[model samples]
Target: MVADTGKTLHADTLKPVNLPEPIAVDEDSAGGPRVVTLGRKLPVAVIDDVWRIDDEWWRARALSRMYYAVILVNGRRLTIFKDLVDGKWYHQTY
Candidate 1:
């Protein structure tokens, strides 16, 4: 489905499921992992759910992290992730 600009219309969280190349996130959250800004901080939505993932056991140094798919009050969607190893979270704007 082509959108207004003629680009293929893809649903939010439509990225091919995969983790970023073992990168570090910013400040950790005490309230637990949660998403705030998305879409490059301009966000179409605010994350509502946080999902955790840590599979780099093979790479002992890689820290496992949490991910979130925020359902903004506007009904938009955004993805966020946090590192459990260090307790930091990063936002993935849709």
Candidate 2:
């Protein structure tokens, strides 16, 4: 038996809070997604495309580019740019 937390829920229904459906991620890490945001428990932007290239080939562990396309709840579009060297993704607002 499950206790009701003042909210009616089915046996199969899970709490929506803190449970975000990850749309996309720049890369996989033991710590989870690098950049994460939720519009309605769903990612407004997901990493649908990825471009990985070994940069500074002469140098060890060079930087790479990772691109992502995100669709916000308000129909707003955004592009996520990430630098693999430092593992950072920036949101591009249009």
Candidate 3:
């Protein structure tokens, strides 16, 4: 079962807490990341949903990401994203 985390998007909730973690991702044949390793090499138990956002594309610091709301093998739900612009992964919490 998915955990019931309340959805509250405050202004301070989206701070740039970029730690720049290096993750090992297993991608599909089409080049889509299917599995990701956070701290324990957890497989994606459930992909609750996914979405993409393309912002500030004209600027140098463009933000393009494919965000996934996935449940890990350890049963922790997390909001992670892949930076389409630079091909990096980040784990975010609010």
**Tens-digit lDDT string for candidate 2 (1-94):** 9987797778678654532122434344642334445433343444445555566867776757555565655555656656566765555444
Least well predicted 10-residue stretch by lDDT in candidate 1:
19-28
Q: For each candidate, what is the lDDT?
A: 0.53, 0.52, 0.78
**Ranking of candidates on TM-score, top first:** 3, 1, 2
Off by over 4 Å in 2: 1-42, 45-48, 59-61, 92-94
Candidate 3 regions exceeding 4 Å error are 1-22
The clash count for each model shown is 7, 1, 0
Which has the greatest lDDT? 3
For model 3, where is the 10-residue window of minimal lDDT?
16-25
Q: Model 1 scores what on Cα lDDT?
A: 0.53
Which candidate wins on TM-score? Answer: 3
| TM-score per model over all chains | 0.44, 0.40, 0.67
